[model samples]
Target: MTKKGDQRQAEELDPRKQTILKAVVDDYVETAEPVGSESLLQRYPLGVKPATVRNEMATISDMGYLHQPHTSAGRAPTHRGYRYYVDRLAEPMNEDEARQIARRLAKTVESQPEMVTATLRMLSGITRYAAVATTARDQSLKLLKCVVTPLTRGRALMMCAFDNGSVDSHVVDLGSALSAQQMRRLNASIAKLVEGQQAAEVVALKLSLPVVEDRFLQDAIARTLRAAQSSARVATRGELYYEGILKMMEHVEFQRSLESLEQVLGALQDKHRVYDAMEQTPENELSVMVGEENPVPELQNCSMVVARYKAGKREGGVIGVVGPARMRYSETLPLVQQMARSLSGVLAKLIEE
Candidate 1:
């Protein structure tokens, strides 16, 4: 039988390999270039010969963790390499540092739009990579209140307030005029039924309510509820900051990668498509999809990092960043996590207010 110690060791990289891998990844991240054994030794005190490091790099390359560009003199980590580094080699943020980062993000961006824009800017600025922050689709919206006001003999305006403090208004046309008392009764009934339910649930409940004496009023209410339900469908907004676009032109792989990125951005612009992609991802998990692992072929040359942010008990959204496979995971991971947490906190407070 395999010993427990053996199993544990099998799950982890050998110390020498781990150190070399870390050194290589760190060097590539800083320089944004392929790393060689000579440079690795110069940057790290590994007490090893250049030839020995070169052999280890070859082993890593054979394992599909490193790739050599035709034009470059050395090797760069592949997406698989980045995955292993993130899952095992990277250090976790300390409690105090995490809190400080969270606080800084919270103080910097005060609104939803600001939060998204700031996140995209920061991701691009720090990583010198293209960045994206897409809003989550399929968020559940709760009704906080509803108000109905008669605008004409055969028309009325309905205003709905979501628990997230976003208000939607619609105008409904009735077949004929109704008395003020009849309007009051209809308003009271709708407010009571919709104040604590989702748009779909409200529509279902309204349909089951006892039909009033005036069929016209009942029809108007149904139409209004349907309009509200349609309006509540998931909507996505985002900011895509393409940093170092010119810098990418310096690499051959980027020639094809840039074209793919444009198509991906176009897909993101269609809110429904963005929602569909975000919903396919699981909640409360940091998802990383690289190269061909992406469902969208246009993303084949890119890597995406996604996480969800909740606004208190009701509203929520998703935040994500996109970059090349060789992007820096150690820095980007913490930054994204911190941004999501701070965004949730700010949105929760805004909705509460």
Candidate 2:
């Protein structure tokens, strides 16, 4: 079946089915227990007989939206059911609800760097699911200022400052010593060559510079530029917080899926994976992945919600959340989006300062 067909089939539940589905999902989400028709009818007014509800639950289970943990136990919504409910049945966040989330996010973070931590905490606290926030490997770097500092007779230090107020230093060996005045001149010249350029661009610019016949300064400048460029290309990752891990363990599905999640989290430490994921993201949009939709196997059983946020007009990063596939999309989507927006606002202000 086509993707839409799968979604539609899941959501094609009738009113009674929807009512029961919602009840099961809600009760399970709250109590982490299998929900029986009688318990559901008693807990929430469904305006239907228990036998009818039972029959409908049977159909829902047959449709792959609900599952029976045992032969006689009540039904619980499966991942398919959760996906269907999220896509069609769950109530969209209203303006008041969105505003409340915005207010809550605003109160937690005072600076840009703090936003990642605040966002993870907020998501975990609000959703009672494990929340994760990661800054893309590529997002943490930018050109600020590049300067060549002489370390000794034949060694020099290439220092580059990023707009994020981070300074990176790399050592370069010179072929020969030069006077302080000559070194100063070379520093100014190299700064002019690549002060504001991106790390990759700086490397290209260095390679294309006209070859000078003067061997000493030529070698020094070449080595200095190479060091500076290498420093710029270095990826620095911001903190990734995994909140409500205990809550995640509370869910049977999550416990079963923890091995996959651990693999994904372990792979996240590989800068390339995080960078590839970030690069694959379309600009100025929020990306959602629901079970099997994620490219990584470790995330196949989880839903990933990611959004890119700018620190200023030109600088930015990404924030994301990872949780069980049965996550509350209605609530998590808006929460993740709002956190990204709020983080961007705070980051922009910090950049201005």
Candidate 3:
């Protein structure tokens, strides 16, 4: 989600202060160490006296941009500081990099799942952080086929297969015996009626049909609708895939123990939870939830950078990376957006195919 501007409205930063903020974030991201005014002066030609830089650092710290980790250690950018850097100061991804990413994806990806995996892998590899993609979107489910198979003398199973390659089946008690001819007619009727219909449309079942002479097949068709709806309800819970969890472990933030890493992964393992985080951010806008800004305590020490990617023309999915609060937002943010564009193209092509 885009950062809300009201938080920064209390006191508009001067141009010099913005430069200090950007320098501090850039240096910290590079070194993963606290940044001091002296280092800023040495690395950047700020044209400000050392004392003035120190004073401004204190002012920005008071404004919640920078924080001193220890009395002896230099100050570092707070979550608010990262927010300001992303919204106002981060550099755009140059065309050369974007074109390179396009060429790379075009050569390697050949299928929908491959494209999704490649995008998450690219994000994880480049950001050097845990990356996640929610691959199963419920809205993308469309009826591919519906069939009824006899289970016993008076019972059968109604099965519905969707475009996403998911199958859902429900047992139907026939009550009366269904002959082979009767079952064939019922399956043909259902296949014809649900040919291009969505799950909801299948459930509604507004189909023009000849009067069914077979009572058992009539009951079976009614039960098939229930089975499709059940599948639709089950699909609301999407599947989650994660990569580069070990990359996250290398960061100092997670080096103390494996507990933090475990907690973060456990929290993210739930597809619905991660999907909510992605959707909770502004639609079609890249969002950066830094450190304590994250709603879940497990992610309070980390950051979640996410955006939605279109799945063909009608459906969409979530993609994101998780790393320490001190992240290369300037580098990773644009890369994630780039990977999403490539993945969207792959999905659109699959839809066409």
Best by TM-score: 3
lDDT of 1 by residue, 1-353 (tens): 00000111123467888888888888987777789999899989999899999998888787777789865579888766776777778765567876876676667636667666776566566666555555544335677787878888788887887776778787877556778887888787777667777755764664566577778778766766665555454311233323333333443456555675566556445555444454455667666665555555565566666677776775366666666666667777776677677777877877687
TM-scores, one per candidate = 0.60, 0.60, 0.71
Q: Any residue pairs clashing in model 2, and if so which?
A: none
Ranking by lDDT: 3, 2, 1
lDDT of 2 by residue, 105-215 (tens): 667546655676777777777777666555544543557788777788788877888877778888778778877977886787688777877665665776665466667
Model 2 clash count equals: 0
Per-prediction CA RMSD (Å): 11.1, 9.9, 9.3
Q: Compute the lDDT of residue 57 as modeled in candidate 3.
A: 93
For candidate 3, lDDT tens digit of each residue in 1-353?
Answer: 47422354545589999999899999998887899889999999999999999999999999988999999888899888887787788888999999888777766646666677777787788789999877545654688887878778777788877777878787877676778887788678778777557765665663544457666677776666555566655544466778887787788767766898788777776655666566565557777787777766677778888777887876567788988888898888898888877777777777787
Global lDDT of each model?
0.66, 0.69, 0.76
lDDT of 2 at 6: 26
Alpha-carbon runs more than 4 Å astray in model 2 = 1-11, 107-111, 136-247, 250-286
Candidate 2 vs candidate 3: which has greater lDDT?
3
Model 1 scores a C-alpha lDDT of 0.66
Residue-level lDDT for 88 in candidate 2: 65
Candidate 2, which ten residues in sequence have the lowest lDDT sum?
Answer: 1-10
